[model samples]
Target chain A: MILVTLLIGVLVLVLVIMAMGPLESLGWWSDKGAEKAAATIERLREEHARSDLRTSYSRYVVYLSGIGAIDGESRPPEEEPFVAAIRDGVPSACLVTDVFPYSVSNHGLTAQRPMSWLWRRIEQARFKNPEAMLAMLVNLRNAIQLFVSADRRYGPTYNIGTAQQVLESLLRHGYRLGSGVPVTLVGWSGGAQISLGAAWYLGLTKIPLELISIGGMMSDDYGLDRLQHVYHLRGTKDPFEKLGWVMFAGRWPIAVGSPWSRAVKENRITIYDIGPMQHNVKDHYFDPTAIAPDGRSYLQVTSDAVVALLNGTEVQVIPT
Target chain B: MGDFLGSLWRAILGVWGLDSSMAEWFRDYPHSLEISITIAMLAGVSTLLGNSVVLFLNRIRGWRFALSLVFNGVSMVALFVVQAVVIALIGFLFTGDRLTFFQAARAVMLATAPLLFGFLELAPYLGPGIARVLQVWSLLALWTVVTVVYAVGYWEALLITGIGWAVMQGLSWALARPLSALGNTIWRALSGSPTLLTAQDLLSGHQFMPVEFDFDVSAVEGGERS
Candidate 1:
């Protein structure tokens, strides 16, 4: 009889829980302003969840992800090892964070589906998703490819949307350099092109802009002429940068009459050929002060370049 | 090919009133009437010749199937048409005259429509698998028409069609085998291929695996910085 009564009580509780949503049921135990308080709490959580935005001071540091960046809170501050290096290395007065162009989750250009157990498993397993690509193409509503606020090649333009977002976040929350902050971009591999595109989309030239492409591609150099300063840092061993040139050989039309040539002549674009750096940057991240296999720390050199640019100067480059 | 097989399994279950999810297999199909008709006619002819040759040509190693179209293309189509009509009439009587012969015939045709994809059966390894799939889809299509179009009870519609189909199948087994054998014997005596094509080689699929394909598509996708 006691067991039967207990079962009945459990069933009733379950029924009550089902009849009221979990939040609303919890709210009953709280005060009159529970809903409003929840709303405010949720709002603050959203602001906090913008993990991509980190404010320092007047100088803004926008970090873009390359081809193999980890998603969400799975890793440490070094989830983005290169960005983490910049965040730790840069002055406390500068804001530093990675951007999300085509985020698979809730933020940025998201493609949400109520997944089944199998679908969820597949989602966890990172594979080439042509379905998302097709979806983006089908839903595209852009007027010009150059200004289309997206990465036309694949998923959301992580670089394009992120650059604007960093600027907006600074304006909304940063104490200094909100609208007229000097911005420094540190991009690796494909991130360099994205950073380049972001500079164009956000019109970062209006402020003091220093763009860095660390062994990145040049699919279209539409934004090369506009940035205040440009840096192309090629690692001795990285093949990804060479892939773009290999695929587009007119031959190596990117060299002749390239916008960078003019920029280079005007002392606006600097190319650094680092001898010891590989495409991965695993060796480069270890010691900021120590010299690399190339005899000097490329990381220190790149950061110093940003520092010099912020100071209205240039980093000397070994001529290509 | 897996997609086609999955659709077939769904269709088989659908005919037995298990689930009506069979249409998903052909949901993307344009349902072009002209294409469907052309395919059905082409398949009817090919099936007729293939079955006839397989059954009759090699009397020493003779085998038989439930249905054949080679020598009896007209007969088989006519028999199925008759079977559908009988099912429609029986359904009308069973359901208090709610279903008409014409409506049921239209439904039957619609049900058989996906079988036109069997046309792809000539594409080496994948053909037989896809054709087998279409046959299952055809049955499911019949169930769809009976239930959704005629508004009949799922079980009753299944029963009426099942009985008619079984009867026709029995009749074909009894009559089709002997007739095809006689035709093959006569043809062999006249102009049939002297060397028999091995049944194993003809029916069994390729032993090779599907080609492996890989792409670094996520490289193009923007995610968190790795």
Candidate 2:
């Protein structure tokens, strides 16, 4: 009777916990503020499409995925406007590449469904436990292995392999990046990995490329000198970029590659810091800084960086 | 405030089979301090947990092993085949009026969406081990997709919460096998130690000491085969 009562009590507790989860979530629910961002992206796409260029481009375009948005490529065309935006460029074919969340890097191990679930449950109980967080991160090695081998259904379903396939096919189709003209590579977060990889691939074919890393992490051996232009955007208080959170006791990727390192290196790497934004790459463009030391708005600073890169001028910012 | 009350009334009426105005649904929803804070916390916690589970599964098994990939591919192709039969069954079992195919598909998706994440969590510990590099690459891809979909727009709150919980439970169950293996390994390590177990150890099921030799001497009862 005692055993039966204990088992029943445990079952009841489990049910109660499960039932409480929805109420907690509902009480705190807010629609993800992504639609507004999408509109902005659409505008950017249109602006890029309408930009004056000397050469007529083919219908071939490159699709770069952002952080936490790798699966964007596989999503049905009808459901995603981004694909249509790229398609408008009239590229004979498109390569929708998964870029960010740095899937191939150690950072990829830190981003997974199980850890997110546990984090939510813990936070709901108003408990902030570091041990729990570390335990969740321990499975990093396993996650990396799974990504490389499994097919879409049987595994994480990331199209990392298809990236190579796309590169191969582009060659077969006679698509080539000119050495003199700067090839543009836009990336956010892990998508930056794709940008770097794509740049390297293009370099293998002797193409000169320019890379724009919005809200990206850098490595010491990133070889930024290889690119015609490199833009490193960092948010001042973005949780992901903040020293405390970015390193998170030294487990996170940013802990290893301080953005300051790029400024020190004479690799044509320009680093811009936007204050108090949460890991948003586009935050670089928002003029939100208070009391600028240089007496310029954040937007002006960003525009200047772009203009400087375009005009091939040098700016005097010393390495820390 | 009046718009809010009107929407509430319309919602109540709509539940009772009335045509409710859009104002009732949109205007009436509470945007109060208490409600907003609660909603924000809920959304934050839900996302934290949901993403945690995704991260955990990806870490343990990797993204390439996520079950959602299979289900999405299958659904993409065979959604109609599932709808025809499942919808008919649900209609017969509930209201006696058959549900439309779209309705049925929606119902199924709502019910099974959580299971997809759960399967992703379980795939790693339960299946044959995959190459580590491939696993990470795939996970990066999966993580990117999920983020984009959710980041681009606000999805149903209920769906997010449900899916998050399902994944956590499914992953826990999947890793149980690996956990058991680990437990056995620990047990063997302890048993093989040369030192005798203490009284406190006995209380903790560590009283037994390992013999100097580590051989089994059980007699063979069965006759030897020719």
The number of the candidate with the highest TM-score is 1
i-RMS, each model, one decimal: 29.4, 22.4
Q: Can you write out model 2's per-residue Cα lDDT over A214-284, one digit (the tens) per residue?
A: 55543322334345667766556555444323322222444445333443444566666543335533333
Which 10-residue span in candidate 1 chain A carries the lowest summed lDDT?
A138-147
Q: After superposition, how far is residue B134 of candidate 1 from its true place, in Å?
A: 31
lDDT of residue A157 for candidate 2: 22
Worst-scoring 10-residue span by lDDT in model 2 chain B: B213-222
**lDDT by residue (tens digit), candidate 1, A108-181:** 22223322343334334434442334323211211012122222222122233444445455445462332455
Error of 1 at A125 (Å): 10
Which candidate's lDDT is highest? Answer: 1
TM-score of each: 0.37, 0.29
TM-score of model number 2: 0.29
Model 1, B1-226: lDDT tens digits are 6754454445434443424444333333344233234434654554443233223212112222232222245444554476567767767777766655545554554465554334343322223444576666666566665665545677976776676666555555565556445444643564433323221221121111111112122222232123
TM-score of chain B of 1: 0.48
TM-score of 1: 0.37
